[model samples]
Target: MVTTRVTWDSLPDSIRRDIEARTGPLSSVEPVSSGFNSELAVVLRSADGATFVKGLRADHPRVWTQNREKAVNPHVRPVTAALRWSIDNDEWNLLAFEHTPGRHIDYSPGSLDLAKFVQSLRTLQELPCPDIELKLAEKRWASYTDSPELFAGDYVLHTEWSPSNVLVGDAALFVDWAWATRGAAWIDPACWVVWLIASGHSPQDAESWAAQIPSWNDAPADAVAAFAAAQAAMWSAIAEADPEPWIKDMAAAAQRWSESRRIGARSQTAR
Candidate 1:
């Protein structure tokens, strides 16, 4: 078994000290998923109850990323109903939020858990973010990826829609505020469906999951060619930059999406 090391001692002491000051001495620290950008730590405090602390790791330009969140969070505060606040170490950037309680559904496409994923993503799109740097969401995904029949216009920007990133308890709470922006709302769900289809799930299963989103009642109609293109561009970068096994999985799914689009288009023309 390959172990991913995430320990409280691995974080900067100065950062922990600052958290202690604010939350009033954390009693227990449980490291959660450190996905792509930050290390998620659930801190239980004596007086303050529970809080989430995301310690920014060095590699992925976190200071600028969190700074972007710092700028738009206030605007989205009322909309998302999720708190996003950044702390500065005068050298590094970390984000602290009120730990929303929920179950992190470990879902892939075709699972009933996909409903939570779609609802959470749509809610994020509904969030008012006039101050966000939309280009920040682009992340130059299209340039690296190749597909002759490109369909990149079916959604707002895809986020950390993977099952682990989504927490479902009282509600679907999307924790990662990074890589969020606007486009066609369907793009993210299409990406999720790709996850389902690739995970030994049939097209029927994919349709059931996609239909869970009322906006996507006609699942095939909702699966626009543009959505496939957008997903291909969005995920190809992760495949290149990270050594994570899931990235490889996404890359293959992206290519399959391209092929599926081509075949579907051709089948329609044949009629």
Candidate 2:
């Protein structure tokens, strides 16, 4: 569910002062509306430069996500906006990132952004999972599959592939590390396959595009099949609970990809 956003002026005076003290007296404040997770999302400008701030009330249920992003930031350098500073007071838990300039990526078939997007995935695929507190992929999907161990690995996984989480400028930059996980290197590309399908790629074509990431090629066939099935089930449940058009579309895409993988498995068995 989307959190109700708070305006810049709604913050307590003491909180505003604390932020300005770190940002050098904000000259301008613009609320950012693109992301859904943060109750406080804005761009602050000061004499020095601009900073992007996102936060939740200290007592918010998901406030732990703030700490996850902070712990993961140092490991995910130029591919993500640099973390400038963070604040945790009685009122709020906030993070400030260098203001990165870019538009969200277009995942539509034939768009030029595909190559850059895949390259960014390749960069992420090469990074080893940092020894930090991250949820294990197996545990995350345990309810969806009997063989959750198939998802285990030593690589960092950016499991969410929504177009909005990626920014395209001089290069593709991934944002929102709150859901980052430790999983098989191929799982990231596997996750992207669903979004690619939703963006008008055939299941086969989506898998082909995912093939651009070398790790995708190394994936065990059974593991990939299990992951695909799990995604289909997971998205279907989400769609059923919400019934939003976009959510239904994602559910359909995941189902299509899962069926395609099942067919491929049967074909191999028949041979």
Candidate 3:
């Protein structure tokens, strides 16, 4: 669900003062229009430099996402912008990160950004899952599949693959660790396949791209098929609840990939 966006000028005076104290009198504020998770997403510029800030009301239902991002940032180094500071008051909770300028990644077929994205994933896969409180993949997807245990693993997983979550400049950088999870390493690339399909790649082409990731190559065919089916169910529920066009597109992409996997499984069984 997209949080209602709040402008910089609309922030409570106390909150603005608290931020300015840390950032040293903001000279300019650029509201970030991408990503749905934060009520306040902006770039604050001062004589010192720029800082990226994202925050939520202290009492918001998803307030814990702020804590999750803070905890995970230190572990996920240069792959993500460094979290510089945080503020929590009776009214709000916010995190400040080193501002890095970049454009969102393009998942379209034949895009050069695809190779950069895969490289970024390879770098991320090398990092061990830090000992932090995070949602486990099996538990998160349990409602969508009977065999939730198949999704269990100790490896860190950034399960959301939306283009907005990745930025490419000198290098590809991943943001919004809000939905980060602990799961099988292969699951990250598997999740990306659906977004690839949504971006105009056929299921076969998407799988081919995912196969480039080392962990994906190690995933069992049956387990991947199961994951695809579970994802189809999961996205269907999400789209049904929101009825948003983008959500519906993702739901259709997931279903197509799931069906393709089922067909492949049947062909193998016949063989």
lDDT, candidate 2, equals 0.93
Q: What is the TM-score of each candidate against the true structure?
A: 0.75, 0.98, 0.99
lDDT score, residue 236, model 3? 98
**Candidate 3: pairs in clash:** none
Off by over 4 Å in 3: none
Question: For model 2, where is the 10-residue window of minimal lDDT?
Answer: 120-129
18-123, model 3: which lDDT tens digit per residue?
Answer: 9998999778999999999999999999988999999999999999999999999999985999999999889999999999899999899899999998898999
Expressed as tens digits, the lDDT of each residue in 5-97 for candidate 2 is 999999999989999999997789998998779999999999989999999999999999999999999998858999999999889999999
Better of 1 and 3 by lDDT: 3
lDDT of every model, 2 decimals: 0.58, 0.93, 0.93
lDDT of 1 by residue, 135-237 (tens): 4323334454353223233334544566556667645666555656554454456656777766756545664676666545533453456556656665676
Superior by TM-score: candidate 1 or candidate 2: 2
Regions more than 4 Å wrong, model 1: 1-7, 10-13, 39-42, 57-60, 72-81, 108-110, 136-139, 144-158, 211-223, 226-230, 233-244
Residue 231 error for model 3, in Å? 0.6
